[model samples]
Target: MTHTWALVNLKPGVGKSTTAVFAAQAAYEEGLKPLLVDADDGRSCLAAYNRADGFKWPVIGLAEPDLHRKLPDLDGGVDLVIIDVPQVEDHARIARGALRYADTWIVPVAPSHYEVDRMFEPPRGAADDSGRYRLLEFFEEVQDMRRSPADVVVSLNRTNRAKRTKTGPDAEVREALEDKGFEVLNTVIPWHDDRFRQAILPRTPGTNMRRLVRELLDRKGATQ
Candidate 1:
């Protein structure tokens, strides 16, 4: 089965390229022909894919974000294509374009109030004012990309394990997403310099990157 995924959001500084590069690399590692499509002009993921050497997969850089008109062929040899999109005021346009061809859309939210609020804003506005209660449920119903059952995952990235706050922004946002029956990834990518440094280079996913990818691709409840 072919799967196309887009890592998107209107939120910037939230590790969009990192998630896109590795997820495609992960698909390749699983013996699939993965294609890394860089939707942003930043070329960060393309730079990383070029520097992170020893990749057994093929990653293509698409400077344009409109896959609806740009993607030439997806079913021929591409088993999976991961896209890194721009985080802008209207990224919802590019994201919606990606969703036109995506099997899943992964919105990586950095563990912070600002990031969460920004990430949830677009989908939130679609919500009906149910007195601010059960608002997340309304968000999910409207956020589904495919009428055939869309899988929109809210993944927490750049998390701090050392920090402990029971009812913080991270917990609350995640709770809202999960309360609506969304499948949240269990492994949160830690905030590390190496990850940012590695983003400049390209090729294969690192150990930490691979672990997080496994968390996303693994069975719903099975232990990794």
Candidate 2:
């Protein structure tokens, strides 16, 4: 059976596509066949695949909302499928579809309170009337639509060495997420613009990314 993991968040710029691409790269390095599904209308993952000299796995663009139904036809016999879901604020349907389809869900968040608040922003003109993004609430709502509680983990991305230590932005964010009862991943992707931001191929996965991959695979193995 194929394993599917979707990188989702309430807002963009939280390393969703970057995490998707690198996670696929890491999964490929682990000797597993991995396919990347770009479910975001932004098409960032597709563009990255197009620009690469030799992308490791197949990347397809299916920005439609019926991912749970469409993905089986496109798995192409791969062992793993990593999806880059669009931000929930503007693309709720597509995001919800990806959430419903994937067995494992990863929410990549930066170590900032501002970003945290952005995740709670409700969709435009939403009746919530909270004047905030309803992303966090939306994510919880989607869980009920799933057959079971998916293995969801929060990945702290774009952290520096200092912030990742005992007390800093990383610690603060992790605590905040934990307070909300979310499982935060131990592997933290550092702030490396040349490596991660505007990423190019023919490059090796960084230590943090490799660790993240290993941690995820370990969790996958444990469940199996």
Q: What is the lDDT, from 0 to 100, of the residue 148 in candidate 1?
A: 53
Write down the TM-score of every candidate: 0.71, 0.90
Off by over 4 Å in 2: 122-133, 162-164
TM-score of 1: 0.71
| Local accuracy of candidate 1 as per-residue lDDT tens digits, 72-149 | 465467776787867644454665566666656677877766665555453444453433422243334335644554
Of the candidates shown, which would achieve the greatest TM-score relative to the real structure? 2
Q: Give the lowest summed-lDDT range of ten residues in model 1.
A: 130-139
**Top candidate, metric lDDT:** 2
Give the Cα-based TM-score of candidate 2 against the true structure.
0.90
- Per-residue lDDT over 52-157 for candidate 2, one digit per residue giving the tens place of the 0 to 100 score: 8559689989999999889888886899999999988789899888989898999999889998777656666776566544665676788889888779999998
